[model samples]
Target: MGAGGGASATEGDPFWRRAAWVAVLAAAYFVAGRLSLALAFARLAAPTIWLPAGIAVAAFLLGGPWMWPGVFLGSLFVSAASGRTAWVAVPIAAGNVLEAWLGAWAARRFARGRAAFERPRHIAAFAFLSGAASATVGAVIGAASLCRGSLLSWDGCGATALTWWLADAAGIIVVAPIVILAAMERRDRWNKEKSAEAGLLFASVLLIGWAVLGGAPASRNYPLDFLCLPVILWPAFRFGPAETALTALVLSGAAVGGALRGLGPFSRGNEIETVLLLQSFSAITAAAALAVAAVVAERRKDQEVLQGSRRSLEAAVRERTETLTKTLGELESEIARRGLVETALERRTRELAHSNQELHQFAAVVSHELQEPLRKILTFGDLLKGMAADPRREEWEYAERMEDAARRMQRLVEGILELSRTTGDAPPLGPVDLGEVAREAALDFEPLVAEMGGNLFIGPLPIIGADRAQMRRLFSNLISNAYKFRKKEDAPRIRISAESPQRGFVRILVEDNGIGFEDEFTEMIFKPFGRLHRRADYEGSGLGLAICRRIAMRHGGDITAKGRPGEGAVFAVTLPV
Candidate 1:
């Protein structure tokens, strides 16, 4: 219970403080309102300019509706002090309060919020709603009050009400925006440059207003009213809305005061006409100046925002460029490292290829040297076997075996030499008729085929880029192997056929009806010294097919064998066309 009481007291404190402030502000408003009415009132008890109307509206918009009671109390005091009874003062005060209320409502509705006057649209809206529209309501009500109280004649009521409306409108346009804009301006200390410019503008406005509106009694016919426009535009172009609004208000007050005293360019007509003309001039000048100043302020803000965005975009681009440059540097370093590795690999390949070539040449030289010794051994054994002095059968048989062994050794050496030559480099390739090469190889093996009672067949073949000698050797070895491996009971039937199986390559199949081996030994037959039959059985050095395989490889082609244990063997050779 004690805590609740304390909370209530805390909340009540602000309310009491607000009430005290409202009372003080109302007293101040009443004093200022009475003073403005006394100074600007015409003979009909209507003011040519009502400054308190502008003050009331500015207060409500800036301080919010909480200050409305102060506006009401001030209007009531001003009306009663102007010599109206309670009944008359009451309605006139109500009209004044309604005027401020309507103006605040219109500002919040149309101007979007409190009138900062930073844009031309905001200024124009305030002029139409608060200046022109709200002032009409107060004029109508105040004029009717004058008629009800018998203070103004019905005949003069129209002109007096018009004067009242123009005065209120002029006051709102000239004063309200100035007070609102000043209150909202940032609390920055003035620099030397700003202070100098502001001082010049203030001096110019004062001098022009004095010359145009404060004319001497004898010089009332002079034409100097339009000279105030440059002075009004000076602050609008240089400073901003706040300075422009204030300058216009000061000029308007001077002009209206002069015309009321019958001393300015608008003083030629009746008093009401003179007041209306001055009000019209002041209202138009203030509206135009405020609008131009708002436009200048809005443009400056847009330029600042645009410059900030450009700076941010430039900064982002610089950051992205720096990242890309670093990435490119990394990629270049990786490429350099790979290039060095490739160079080393190529050098090693060339060295290994050179070593292989030298080894092949050494084998050929060794085989050629061994052939002479084997030939001498065979010749000596044959001469010994034919001698008449050795009549023993066993002795002749031993001599025969010795000669055969020597001849076999000589054949082995020759086969090695031929194999080495096939593996080494050959002549460059050219366009040669493969069919002609096959036919020639078949012709050379014709006598051997007849001796073995075998048949050989050759097919048409494409012309290809190849070494012709290598192609002939390749076909010769295959045909000879076919005759050598023939079954004893069956005559060998060899067929050679060529066909283009795919683009850029041709396949030639050499098939024979011979004593074939197992499929597992197909790859083994292509190795050096690899053979399917023994030397005693097939009379070979086991290098025939090996040499054929080497020849095919050197020409960028390959040979593969397919066979069954009792069926014929087929060798398929694929070469680039």
Candidate 2:
């Protein structure tokens, strides 16, 4: 049972399977080599052709070094079948095996791993090193073996060695790459164009080969063997190495067969010389075809790589463009949203301004209405005073107080009306001489200036765009304030001057020697009804400064005040010219 199990295990092993394949290949090599030798055995010195050397090298390369035994067995069978003694057969077989081993080694070492002849340089190296150089070894050893066995004379050994060497070399150059490449070729389906081109190439090579070396007596004079090269080159450029090598093999076989029949260009010489010439042609043709095919394959591979890179770059650019376009769309949406918000804000501001204008108009109308009622009260109180004279002291006092209160109320109404009118709508503005307006204000206060024992001075001013009445009222309010808030012991002195502090605007300065207040109250004095002094101390409504500021602001200008406790005050009003 243990022996039975061992037999089953050996049968199942992968090594046995590989060995079976090698045995089958060796049998095929023996048959092919014997047949080739038998066909060209006209001259023993020149066997003319050897196919098994190429077969052995290709088998070792494809099946690894373990296939060397197949080469030895194949060589031994072929030599022994040729009717040589064991001594001659053994040495010749050994020489053949050594040649195959050497060729396989050179191909692996120099032809770039696995003998993949995909470049011109690699193809050239394989043809020279593996085909020509390694075959010399077998040729020398086999010729020596034949001479020792008395099968060949030493005088003819040189010629026999030369013929053997070239025949083996030609066989390798023509057959090895074809077998290797065909075994490893890609299994792509042949399209219609490729099928058509291949059909044409094969037809042309056959026709041209027959015409040039058809073993016909008339063919030698034509010398048309060169015509077959185009057909060989056709497949080299368009197909892979396998097709190129196959085409070259077919053409070479046809040419050599014709020469062997003594009807081609190489048949003009002696038997040995003729066969050598044929072998040389076959070797050169095989090498050239393989190299060109490798170059074409390399170029195609490079083009494929370049096209792939270009596709990737284009895809990246498209992706980036889409991202940028999306970002730009978002920015546009944000800008549109901000614009809508600004429009809403502007609308609210206009509505508020309209409401303010309506309030000012209403205030002016109400002040005018209050003045008539106050005047009636004052008239009635005065009449009562005159009628009750000398009747009672209390009656006289009450009547006098009534009249004073009525007069104060009247002044208050007038001040409110003036302030509203200045701030509300006014007539269109024109060019007015501000210096003339200042002089008019000063003249109006001349009587009061003289009575108070004070001096009032006016300086030259610029012509500005303004309402004339409004400009006069603006200066009147400022000058009156200077006169009203005077220092009793100082004999108040007031000066009004104008200067253009900057382009497009003029500044009017009203400096006074008056009892000024704190600097902190500067902005406070401009508010409506804002007063630093009690009514009993100043004897007028506190709306004067407020009205002046309103008028200046309406003309696109402003007014500011500076003052110190005991020093004088200066009011600067700026207006656009």
Candidate 3:
């Protein structure tokens, strides 16, 4: 076999491995035979019975097809050295060769991944039966052919065959799994990580039981949950199942060894006792191992479910918290806007009030000082009218002059007072029935509406938080204007309704189809004394919006207008709920 290629050893190297195996097999047989003879010489030649076991174990460890010739040759050498004629030794030699060959065949075909003595059933299946057959066949054939001098009868041959089979089987079951396990134990694979610890723990249950505790307790008739089984399961649970399974097998073999070696009460005796003990031990241990596996697997499953639940709950809480925080931020921004609007309104109100105060003071002064002079002019005009003979022209001219001068001062006083009285002592927050207010406003304008051939319709409304007087006045002003500004060519229609969309506010809308103005004048029309139409076309103090806007501001709300030219205009007033 060309089994070499410098750095990369060729596939042929396994031939060398096979050759080395043969050599070791031959040497072990020869040495064991010599040792057996020495033992035979020492104890007055009584068979102490460890010799055949040595023969079988050596062959089991090193035997293969190529090792057959080596074992046969080694057996021949043992006969030559023993000083016993071929008649006494050649049959033993042939039996050894046959047993070794059979073991090697079984191992090559079946024991690649398994340890020596890995299963009692496997031993019962191949190791025992194969060895028994090899030993019986070789012994009967070799004894008949070469042992013509010994007193070997059928009974003696059968006893010897049974003994040989037992010896061979003991070696195979006790030793092969261990050797196979060693071969499988790569340092890189079997390092003492958690898995390794688990393996060692499992294997140690048998080893330690054999070394320390000796064997299964004499009192146990069936499998009980052993302390060691749980210990093995702990690592098996944490590390993995493969390590645990392998370890369990190792321990099982150990348990068998302990039972067979006669160190405990449960040690092998008759064939029946030996088989039952082995069967029971293997079945119980395997069942316990399986039970541990089931529990550990379930624990891992539960852990995964719990971990998923925790993640889902945390995600839900995080999402809910984020939504709540966003809503709070929006509310805070709205509050800030309200505060800004209130500040601006306060400033503007103060300015308007101050201007009105100044105008009122000036009007008071004018009223006291200018009115007496106007009265005296009227008196002189009357006197002139009485004194003139041609009275129609003189009286008409004097009266017209007096009336024009006095009317200018009266207009100034009234305009000043009306603007000043805009905020005539309003009440604070209270419950206002908006339905009642709308009805009252509609009633106030009903007579005017009939006169103008216009209609005002009120819709459903809700009770809201507000100043009752202010709300009533506000509705009344809007209805009065709706009827007051009817077009000559078309019938005026007004619709009023209330709706609450905002959680914190109520909205009341007054819609109308009338002689609507351009939208550009919408903002300008809300100022004090601001008018969109000429006085000849429509008459008003133009303070309607100013009052509406003031009321809305007082309630922390607003009024907005949306419309198209000549279609209709809608006034939306939002009041805090």
Candidate 4:
């Protein structure tokens, strides 16, 4: 039986549990001692015979190291009180003490988590090794006691030594293993699901019971000898030799009892080979059981590993399916984008052709209107040139101004027509490096900004799809306005910044240190011919800003401005991402 983790729990466990076990052992020792005595009086007449009944088994099994006192003292009392040679007592006591010590030492040394009497390699190595070693000490002391007192011959002492070995081996094997097997089978806890124990315990009850019954028929005088075989084999498979020795003790007692009473058919010599054969049977059975258990455990481990690999493969398939779903979504979006671009191109081409036709009609109407105005201006100027010695010289000057107004109107009309047609067929959207566009535009206006003693700061920029020439125009127009409007003696500072809020869009900002305007004029500035300052003060056609707004709308973007009087103005331009 094997167990791990923690001590198995029971009611009032640990301290009380240990106390209960020790008390039970103490009670069993005394009771078994008394019973052996009563049984002895009914048979052998010597009480010393009762000494083997429980004292040896108790000392070897429960007492651990402390069993020496009970075994040795108990033996001293039993041997002296019995009919053995009066002087043989002390020597026997020494042998018992030595045997107890060896059992304790082996328990502390080789015993593992398996029950105390669990099966070790050899019962002799288990029993006789420690038993033989510690018992040798007792035998030597006994021999010395016999030699000094002259109570027995050297050969007789030698025979007594052999008898002592028999008794000790008997107690350690027959009784020890059975008690340990019972205790182990009593244990319900296990490391596995507990099949190993089920097989062993089931076989233990069957084989050992058979041995007890069959041994009786084999030697009617010592039929108990059959019981010794199962007791020994049980320890080999279910327990170690400490318990085996205990099993051995009960068998020895029974064998000796049956032989002394003339109840068995066998003579003493027949029992020797019987002893050797039991060991052989135990050795083979123990070896086979252990080998089978090892193979089963190994096979179980392999099956678990294969199952884990199958689970991992299933998870990888799920991840691959998710990746394919995302790819399909992107494919769908691409198809929709190309479809929209085709519809927009067809619609825009028709609008452009119609606008061009209207422009031609507008030019003709403007040309006709301008001819009459120019003729009137000429007639007035000619009248003024012919007014010789006239009192109104200021009137002649006013007529000259009329001709100037007509020439300016003609130039404005031409400029308006040019603005409508320019940049109408700009290239399709593509990845445009906005930073490169800003730098090139800045360089073109470098000479002008230097002349005006202005500073231009280009902030962070991002790239997007846009026409490069149109971007250059947008930047040039904003910078020109800022430079021209700078406060007297104040440096013009232009800062350009761009942001990409999404993958396909960009926003560019142009801010300047110049003479700013009021917020009320914001909408007015976008209208044609709308100007905050007189044309005499700023040489502009007032159409530059209106055309800038139109170009921004055509690109699917827009421009707006915010300013505080006497401070500065900032123009925010947003383009499609």
Candidate 5:
């Protein structure tokens, strides 16, 4: 389990889910306690192997510190129900919780938490820190509690504590690895090959253990426990920490059962000596198996890494060869194609030059010839209206219409001339204060905005390398559109602001509460003569936005617009600082 596994399960989980896991942990602890007690010597506070110690350590390591309540409750209930004094159960339960906490803390700090079995150094640290050291806490407290409650003679307290400590240590060395590694084992690790090998390995252990330590085989009790070493070494070499742990545990059960019946090598000693001897053997065997498994696991990982690096190098070489072959063919084709491209490019350059000359000629014609006639028309129409004897007559109305047409023609000609200039050349750039330009633009619309009960605000803007006149025109056109397209029922609310969105560029935003356009017209509205409303409803040559876009492009900047049907619109102009 990783740090995220325990933390997320404890913190992100709902109260009921966490409670259910705690309940399950408590139940398992109690049941393991009962089974451990069944193996205890009569009238003694020591068991051959206290499996619940392993359960507590594994719980704390996997479930995190929040699982302490479960350990406490389980210990309290089991101790009290075992006919111990009710008050004695309190200190014993506290001792169990402390032992688990200490073990988990040490493992997390030095032994790699629940991953202690993965490497040899971490396995050694776990053995010394969690298994041996933490077991002392529970042993001392439990023995003292029993003696204080008058349940055991003071003379026997020291022997009982020694037995308790060894039993707990052995339990941690053997059972804890089984539970932890089994929980973390991936389903993909078990296949036909591994399953068959594991089955064979475990079967050999059980058979060898029964032959060397079984009570029924009286002739086999010849102090030949060393014969089991070969069976224990098999899983250590072939399998992982979980499998090795289980094999040691199985052998331990067989050996202990036979010794208790006075039919094994350990049975030659007195009862306490026999129990201690068996525990020492079990702890040493389990630790050695886990350490050897860690070493083997490390070797396999190194081999896999070396093989992966070799494969990657070969694949890279093959890909490079293929790329070189393909590039040579492309290079030959490109040389032939370059000659044809040069010929076409020369022809297009000539056409583009001719087009530019024609555009300049058109601009001169519109400026000198077209506006003169529109001005004469406007002057003559006004004189005719003054000469009409009856101003309300039909002739006077016709004169008024002629004057309006002439004025509209003048504005259209000027707009066309402006648009032509924007496409002609890049304007000279300078550090122009955009805040001052925006405020100047806002001043032009102030009276109209005030009369209509609307607002126009100019926010702080950056001094950017831009053409001052073009920046002014950009702000003017955007603000004018905001006012013209506003809803009649609502007062126009417009705001201009700027922000540095990236390292080198600043974005200016003009937002308005107005009658916005459809999404499909976001691009169309930037083209010349791209009008959404009719001429009678809104007066414009539809060249304002087109001119704004051209001005932005000349300054190495851009303008974009976003809007909904009626909610509002935001026009963003991004320029380099």
Candidate 6:
């Protein structure tokens, strides 16, 4: 209809393509104008229905505001060809462009453009604003232009303006709807059943129109025009707005032709009066039919949406119900399995507790019995040594050697007993100031450190949660080891410093500048009876570090060591703070 045929005739289109579309639109407009003029009562004025007005409005609505040039050129050509001067034709052309623009703007603003027929309120808006209201623009401008150019007398101007307005309004009401609806997207596809029904409906409307308003004389005078309404409404109810508008256009055309031939009920008066009556009837019928069709369409759409929602909800409920049923079955099975596992675990726990208690008792009994035998041997050996005469004698040397062996045996037994005690049930934890404990351990080593001229530093330490006796023993053993394994040339410089490495834990480091061991012995040194040096060289039961690690672990902490052959060793003990 317009330069772009849709709302795409913007500046972005190629110049040559847009010009081609403009030419097509102008040609269509001029043709429609010439045909509508053939139906006019006056040469320069009153046409019963100006079809070009509807074409111009539809073109603007479909192809956008850029269709103004086509409307202008077409209107100008029609006005000049109808023998009007430039003074009249120019204003008339301008008036036509304004009418098209105003109608399109109002339809888009108040109605929904091509979609206006989908709802009753939008249909009413298009009929009133775009049809009745916008038609006044061209009527007023064209009438004034005719008067100023001396083509129409002042007194006759009112009648010409009224005719112009009514013709344009009728054109929009009857013809614009068909054009717009044709261009719109079809909501319902064509099927054999629907197509047959639509054909039947149109045939029925034509029959009823021909009978009431355009048939033989006997059929027209009985005021049977009211019977035509039901035929128009049939399409509105059975089909949608597009077909409803089409049916109304068909009936209106029939009525107009009958009135022009002076054959229908509206042919009682002059040609102008008969045409006015027919145009009025057509406009009112088309508006009512379109409004009724829109109402039906809207209700149908809402029902469809409601049915879709109900189906989706049912599907979701069914899916969730099935999922929950399977989940409940799995959960019940898991509960039964867990009950059996918990019962077996409780039985194993009881067995383990009994075995640990018996083991502790055996260690205590064995250590006591062994210590008594060693003590008796040492005491008898000492008495025998005293009984010997000379210290250098063979029996005296044998007695001294026996005493030394017995003392070493006693020490080993005591060390084993201490190690067993650490493995037993742990003592209750308390807030122990590790600073005070480290300082106390340092004090215990003071006599040895002073005698050997070695330095022992205890830096600041945090208060922690631990077994007080275990913590004390842990530090003492570490300090004792540092001194025991001192380098021959360098003094044993041992440092005890503490840092909170992370929240809720403190790392107390015991660093020694002494003859450190190899890295391979790091983990082995913490095992029970694990020794990195020969027993004859370093006097230890090889359980000091093992005891230290066990105590740290029982308190939910741990001990780690790093060392080189000559560099200092650092033993980091992490305790909860």
Top-TM-score candidate index: 1
Clashing pairs counted in every model: 0, 0, 7, 42, 0, 1
Order the numbered candidates by lDDT, best leading.
5, 6, 2, 1, 3, 4
Model 1 vs. true fold: TM: 0.73
Q: Which window of 10 residues has the lowest lDDT sum in candidate 3?
A: 1-10
TM-score of structure candidate 6:
0.60
Compared with the true structure, all predictions reach lDDT values of: 0.78, 0.81, 0.57, 0.55, 0.83, 0.83
Off by over 4 Å in 5: 1-9, 216-223, 332-577
Give the C-alpha miss distance for residue 175 in model 4, angstroms.
Answer: 3.2
Better of 1 and 5 by TM-score: 1
- Evaluate residue 42 in candidate 5 and report its C-alpha lDDT on the 0 to 100 scale: 66
Question: In model 6, where do residues sit more than 4 Å from their true spots?
Answer: 1-19, 30-45, 64-126, 133-161, 184-188, 191-193, 216-227, 234-240, 261-265, 293-393, 396-400, 427-577
Relative to the true structure, candidate 3 reaches a TM of 0.45
lDDT of 3 by residue, 1-577 (tens): 1111122222244877666655655676567556544422131111212233334433444333444655676777776774657776666666666665666555545543133233334434444444334445544544453335454554355544444344344334333333333434332344558566745675666655555324655534533335455645654566443344445545544544555455443455554344344434443443344345446655766787899999999999999999999999999999999999999999999998787667756655665566577667667766766666464685667676676555554444443343334444345777878988889878867776667677777888888888887888778777766666556677788899988868988889988886666878788867877877875577565776777777777678888877666767788899888
Deviation of model 1 at 260, angstroms: 7.5
Model 4 segments more than 4 A misplaced: 1-67, 80-91, 110-119, 122-125, 142-154, 178-186, 189-266, 269-426, 429-532, 539-577
The predicted structure with the larger TM-score, 2 or 5, is 2
lDDT for each residue of candidate 1 in 544-563, tens digit (9 for 90 to 100)? 88888888888888999998
Which candidate do you rate higher for TM-score, 1 or 3?
Answer: 1
> 1 or 2: which has the higher TM-score?
1
The all-Cα superposition gives candidate 4 an RMSD in Å to the true structure of 11.9
lDDT of 4 by residue, 1-577 (tens): 1111243222244656545544444444445445445533232122212234224543454435444445555666655545446567766666656665665466445553124332334333444444434545555566557655665566556644554344344334334444444444444355554567545644554444333523345444444534445545554345333333443444444444444343432223444333323322322322332232223323444665777777777777777777777877787888888789978987897787778757756765675676677777777776775673353677766766776676666556654754554434555777777788888878877777777777787886877677766777677777777776777768678889987656666778888878889999888887778889977777666766676776677688888988878888988887885
Q: How many clashes does the backbone of model 6 have?
A: 1
